[model samples]
Target: MYLGSQEMRTVLERDNGTIQKNLKKLTFYYGASDLWCPVQYYEDIKKDFPSGDIRLCKKGIQHAFVTSLTSSREMAAMIRDWLKDDLAEM
Candidate 1:
């Protein structure tokens, strides 16, 4: 995840337009109590990318949700369901 995230960040940093273009169609899910990410970052992202679908986790899952199979499954299912409409159109 770290390597992929860094690579993607590098690509996006090369062009602000690229970030904006892709971000416009993104749905970001941030943990409500994420220790790695402060709440202010989430607030700022919402303001910065108003067109993006940003949401806070309401299921009480910690930032390290991948550590638990149940949390991972739940998040995967939710994301798949969320993208179903756009995926179908594609």
Candidate 2:
């Protein structure tokens, strides 16, 4: 399957009030060396949306993390942990 080499879509902007209202509830995770998204993209979004939970993978995982069983397991566990608190309150 083709992955990480396509051009990005056009940018979309919403009202500041709407963005701020939903920012805190969103979680954005990017691969440390993802080819699909450059570091600049992460930085830009982080600077624009400081209130959101934006995280970069520090485990050296790449864009195709699903190709590796170990990475898949680690990523899945990390996501589970991230959502554990929310699940508990549900």
Candidate 3:
């Protein structure tokens, strides 16, 4: 999902408890360098959902996966390989 600045602000608010609770999983494709949410955010989120699954995909760029990835073929191949590991428990 493409989250705009306004939407992110809404999600970060404590009053949006229902929305926050429903977001059990978070996937970040950082492209290896882009620290979008920062390390402290990751640490804080982990503390809240200690056992929740957080998927991170680091590709061939520094925080520019969405823009730098020239071919979807490589991404598809990577995903297929990653899913084979059976990450259902995490």
Candidate 4:
């Protein structure tokens, strides 16, 4: 499901503000490498949600970083730690 540039622009302009406002109440984890989605996208999202956990892998992992068993385990562990910390604060 891909939206064209114009469609995406319209959707973002209409909805991004609401999304950004609501993000303050949620904990977000975003991981991106130099491989698939450009690091800039993550950076932009980080700007939108300063409290989010935005991790950028300088090693340039593939888009499917979690497909490998080891990578999946590591990802799971990272999320587990984040959730623990988040829950602890509540």
Best by lDDT: 1
lDDT of every model, 2 decimals: 0.79, 0.77, 0.52, 0.62
Deviation in Å, model 3, residue 3 alpha carbon: 7.4
**Candidate 1 vs. true structure, TM-score:** 0.72
- The parts of candidate 4 lying over 4 Å away from their true place are 1-15, 25-32, 58-61
Scored by lDDT, model 2 comes in at 0.77
Per-residue lDDT tens digits of candidate 2, residues 1-90?
Answer: 233223223334434586678886788888778876788777877898887788877889878779999989998998899899768978
Q: Which tens-of-lDDT digit does each residue in 1-90 have in candidate 1? A: 898698867855224476588985777788888886777767878887777788888898888788999998998899888889788978
On the 0 to 100 scale, the lDDT of residue 46 in model 4 is 75
The residue-by-residue lDDT of candidate 4 on 1-90, one tens digit each, is 355566756755325666667764555444454443566777787787677555665444455657888777776776699788888999
TM-score for all models, in order of appearance: 0.72, 0.72, 0.47, 0.61
Clash count of each predicted structure: 0, 0, 2, 0
Q: Write the per-residue lDDT of candidate 3 for residues 13-58, one digit (tens) a residue.
A: 4333552666554343323334565656555655665665544444
Clashing pairs in 3: 33-63, 34-63
> What is the Cα-based lDDT of residue 87 in candidate 3?
78
RMSD to the true structure for each prediction, in A, is 4.2, 3.5, 5.1, 4.3
Candidate 4, pairs of clashing residues: none
Decide which is better by TM-score, 1 or 3.
1
lDDT of 3 at 32: 31
